[model samples]
Target: MSKKVLVTGADGFIGSHLVEELILQGYDVKAFCYYNSFNSWGWLDSFPKSLLDKIEIFTGDVRDPNGVRTAMKGCDMVFHLAALIAIPYSYHSPDSYVDTNIKGTLNIIQAAKDLEIERVLVTSTSEIYGTAQYVPIDEKHPKQPQSPYSASKIGADCMADSFYRSFDMPITIVRPFNTYGPRQSARAIIPTIISQLLNGYEEIKLGDLTPTRDLLFVKDTVKGFIEISKSNFLIGHECNIATNSEISMQKMADTLIHLINPSAKIIQDTDRLRPEKSEVFRLFGDNKKIIEHTNWKVEHTLEQGLQATIDWFSEAENLKQYKAGIYNV
Candidate 1:
């Protein structure tokens, strides 16, 4: 029998892709989506019927230990991806971040220890490193929490590490930098740019364009998760799935403009900017650990990824979901 896997936050961006990939690879998947009054499963609604039919969905909040325990029952492996990820939103309501990111992760870790799940891959972000103190930031880079979102993640990562050391829980933290592709909300730069351009905005509104980031395609990020899960060598270690490259916001905008419409002009929007000191000036991750451990490789180039995202947003059905006029937090 194939391994039974439970994917928390399976309704969201990368989670949805991970679910699809796992199903393709012949895993018996249980999708743990956040429960809602409407019983909606966010992006999972967009998945094909055949694929969706194969998944067993458990709807519940990660903050509730009982709910997490129930969802994780009988699953051999768990991929915990649920969290409040928006940096801007984190500033406004940091308590939610702590409860959901840190506490939620703790619940998962504790449950995993009790259940003796074969493997657990907790999703982490490149934001935890804050502004890169060193070029090509590795797993060893000192963490500087520039935002409450990153801070909450750092705490959760520590909690996972402690679980590994103290209880011998099998866990791996997979951190991906600036993932962008289909189903990505407008809160991220690439989707923000594409949504505005597709909507025929004459002057694109943006925040500080000087900061640099290492962008990974959503598919590449999903591949990293799968590769790490299969590799027994990565247990109890933190690894980054990145392109080991950098791109400025201004250049990113230019690249988007070149793809969609060249006439779009970029304009600064103060509301979109993060607090001066809190903003991460740069993030270029080192992928050496993940590459050395498994056969994971960068499958999508920046141009290829951007074009794929552009094509997805270009569809009228997909474009309608986004409010292109407003800046997403």
Candidate 2:
């Protein structure tokens, strides 16, 4: 029999992709999606009928311990990907970030400990490192939470570490740098650019184009997660899945513009700009640890990945879902 796995936040972009990948890898998957009155499963609902039928969907709030515990039952491993991730939204609602990211992570760890789940993977973000103090940041780099979103993730990481040290619970922190591809929310830069250009917009509204990111494709990230879960050496450790390369927002936008609409221009929209202190200036991650520990490698080049993303967003049905004219966050 295959190992049963539970993936939290399976309704969102990366989470949905992970679920599909896990299913393809022959794991019996249970998806924990945020409960809503609309009865929507977010991106998970976009899956094909065949794929959707294989998943066991649990709808509940991650912040609720009871819900988390209930969803974790009968699963051999847990991938905790649920969190409040939008930095701009976090600035306006730091309290919700605390409740969801920190407390919700606490709920997962506590429940995992109690249940003695074989392995638990907590998702971390590149934003936790803030502007890189040094190039190609290793796992040992100092964490500077420049924004509330990063602050909550930092708290969550500490909690995961505490569980391992204090209770000897098995946990791994999987830190992914700037993962992008199909199904990404318009709030993200890549999708923001793609949707606008595909929507026939002449000007792309953006902010702070100088900040750099170490981009990773979603497929590679999901593969890294699966590989990490299969290895016993990564327990109680943090690892990053990155391309070991960086791209500035301005440069990335220009590349997309060149492909989609060469005539389109990037416009600095004041509303889209982040507060001076909250912006993450640069993120170039070192993937050496994960590469050494797991059977993972960069599969897609930036050009290839961006092309795939553009193709997905170019679909009339998909492009219609995003409001290219307005700032998403």
Candidate 3:
């Protein structure tokens, strides 16, 4: 029998990809998709039938402790990837972020502790290291919570660390910086650019083009998770799955435009702009820790990843799901 693995948030962008990869690798995959009235599995619905048939999906909310505990039973490893991730959405309803990101994570950690799960990978973000006070941000860099989303993740990371120190629970904090690819929600920069360009928009509306970020392709990020899970060196460690590279939003948008539709021009949209002080000005990660610890390497350059994402969105079936004109918070 394959090692049983439970992946929470398997209905979202990265989570769905991770599930497919896990199934391909022969893990007995159990996907925890959020329960919804429409019975929608979100992006999980897009998986090929061959891969889908191999997965055992359980519908539940990570916010519900009883539900989480029930799903965690009999699983050898847990990948906690469920959370309210959109920064703009967090601005309007921070309480939900607290409930889902903080309390929701708390429930997972507690369940892992109770069940003595061998490995628990709690997902984190570069947003925790807000506005990059210094270049090449590392694991030791000071954390500044600029948004409610970031604040909640910081709190969650702290809680995960405490579990390791206090209870000797095996946990790893997997931080990925600005992950983007196919199936990504319109709230992300890459999808926003692609959607607008695909919709035949001449002028793309955007915000804060000056800010720099270390972009990690979704496949690379998912591979990083698998590597960390396999590595003995990563136990109880906070590892970043990132390219030690950076790109400004303007340059990134320009590259996307040139690749997809050269006629498109960028227009600043005030509504999409993050608060001045809260904006993560620069984020170039130092990926030496994960690199030295495991054989994982970043396979896709931003250009390659962007092209693949654009190709996916170019499809009428895929493009129909997104609203390109509206600014997604």
TM-score per candidate, in order?
0.99, 0.99, 0.99
Candidate ordering by lDDT (highest first): 1, 2, 3
- RMSD after CA superposition, every candidate: 0.7, 0.7, 0.8
Write down the lDDT that model 3 would get.
0.92
What TM-score quantifies how close candidate 1 is to the native fold? Answer: 0.99
Tens-digit lDDT track of model 3 for 1-329: 88999999999999999998898788999999999999998898987887788999999999999999999999999999999999989888999999999999999999999999999999999999998878798998999999999999999999999999999989999999889999998899889988988889999999889989899889999999999999877888999888999999899999999998898888888998888878889999989999999989999988789888988999999999999988888
Per-residue lDDT tens digits for candidate 2, residues 289-320, read 99898889999999889899988987898999
**Candidate 2 error regions (>4 Å):** none
TM-score for candidate 2? 0.99
- For residue 111, what is the lDDT in candidate 3? 98
Model 1: lDDT of residue 143: 91
Q: Is candidate 1 or candidate 3 better by lDDT?
A: 1
Question: Lowest summed-lDDT stretch of 10 residues in model 2?
Answer: 271-280
Q: Model 1 lDDT vs. the true structure?
A: 0.94
Clashing pairs in 1: none
What clash pairs does model 2 have? none
TM-score of 3: 0.99
Candidate models: Cα lDDT each:
0.94, 0.93, 0.92
